[model samples]
Target: MPRRTILIVEDERSLAEVLAYNLESEGHEVHVARDGRDGLSKARALLPDLIVLDLMLPVMDGLAVCRELRSDARTKGVRVLMLTAKGEEVDELVGFHMGADDYVTKPFKMKPLVARVRSLLRRPDAEEAEADKVSGAGLEVDRERHTATAGGEDLNLTPTEFRLLWTLMRQPGRPFSRHELMDASRGGDANALERTIDVHVRSLRQKLGDRAETVETVRGVGYRFNENAVAAD
Candidate 1:
């Protein structure tokens, strides 16, 4: 029951109202926006913990809003849960590539939707006793500072990306299944699709640059931090 703030950027008034009402009942503070433009504005202003965005909207579509959110430093770390009437696999991939943390197709059940929202809100707390720093493969991750650096350069990672890297690096040489990585990166509350992890990995690899090979795909399993690639410290 983390008391998190959420923004609902949905043009459908009835649907938005229903979501808001249910979310509020779960002890979350919720805000509503009628269109994509307004949604972006409020997102910057409020900097909510999570955003519930609809794909179809006036003024600005959700895709545009999502891209804007991810591009801006101020809102880049905020979690996004996309809602769409289209349930196609390609559409889901597009949303993930745009930095959405989760996705829900329209005509969804309230219970599962609320459950997904709860999952996004559950992040590791600041006081959690994780190793303050880890260094390997020319990458340095400091949990206390919530920062990562590659080859002495700072990495501007999204929250999900940071967690994914942290999880992998914590157990160098161990293969992590997509489902296991999903839970570690987003918390046990997360309802992330297996493919969603691939999107995050792609973004994370780009940031890793020359050290990208440190995160290796395990093929039939998932991914692992290649201990063999660790640079001599």
Candidate 2:
């Protein structure tokens, strides 16, 4: 793995130092910012491979930073992993809504954090490359263009929804358990309630409308996208 650069936006000096040290040990170039303002500045200047952001920060706050990053075309594709002490569902949902690629509660294990960082950074770029060469069931996903269209209609999906659809579309006939879908779509939080995936899938199906049946429920197994179904919209 090449040396990936990561920006750490955290208020606690000690915790930031510890995280930076661990990430540096894994051969990543780490930069630390104590507040959201500085963090956002460094992010713009450095364009780090990833950002480890804390929800609570002085001045701008992590949510603002995420919004700014997502809004800016230059940084829109940069990966973000929210690191916060808040373990509530609302916080997690808010982070996801603000475009966080992953969320981690504080007092977490270093190994898992590093692994997730590696996994996320590895994903988007490679997937984008592969998606350009792929098409399916009259539904075309152009990752390079960051667009997906089914039956000649564009699917206006949020980033998470797009990731979820991409996961299923990529696998086609494979039955992905709700737990597996949740992990793949929303980052692996084993404690994350199963209903979250259902909610997103429901929303996705609504967007698909008459083509919704293309995504099939496999009794007790979970959900699968059947390319053969080719529902008429």
Candidate 3:
């Protein structure tokens, strides 16, 4: 495999060293930053292929770092994996909302962390990629660009929201159960609560405006995008 650069933003020096060592052993070039502000600066300058970010950091928090990275077009596409000692659903949600591509609680094994990083870097489904390349009614998804526009305006979405919209929009007529959507968008992590998907969907809908109706709720089933809606767009 090619040596991809990975930035590790962790306050714990010993833990950071261990992670950097393991990641380097896995053939990735690793860079370590002990605080969020410095991490953010390094991230912008280095533009690493991936970032392993801790939630709590000095000078700036991980959430802020994530937001800054996402807000900037240059670094928005860089994948992020949040590492934190906090295991609460809300904390995870906050990280996801701030643009984390994945969340792993601390006390995690290095192997799984590496696996998650690899998974995030892997190419998305070819079919989904094809579907997201164009616009649909009330929804316009551009997978390569990581953008979704509804009603001719860009929706300010977190990375997770963009992934969820891509998944649902690609299927169009297909109804995806919460579990299926979660798997498709959140890497099938059982630790990811169903409510997280719901929260993101609600946020997506709010930003979508008139296009919101296209995202149909199937009651007990889950949700589906309206095919006709995309055609109308």
Report model 1's TM-score to 2 decimal places. Answer: 0.54
Ranking by lDDT: 1, 2, 3
lDDT agreement with native, every candidate: 0.82, 0.79, 0.78
Candidate number that wins on lDDT, 2 or 3: 2
lDDT of 2 by residue, 95-127 (tens): 999999999998899899989988987875743
Q: Which stretches of candidate 2 lie over 4 Å from their true place?
A: 126-233
- Candidate 1 vs candidate 3, TM-score winner: 1
lDDT of 3 by residue, 157-221 (tens): 87667767776775577677776665445531337787788988899788777777778899898
* Top-lDDT structure, candidate number: 1
Model 3 scores a TM of 0.53
User: Each candidate's root-mean-square deviation in Å?
Assistant: 15.0, 15.8, 15.4
lDDT of 1 by residue, 6-56 (tens): 889999989988998999899766778899998987676455678999999
Model 2, TM vs. native: 0.54
| Runs off by more than 4 Å, candidate 3 | 125-233
User: Candidates' TM-scores?
Assistant: 0.54, 0.54, 0.53
Error of 2 at 85 (Å): 1.0
**For candidate 3, which ten residues in a row score worst on lDDT?**
123-132
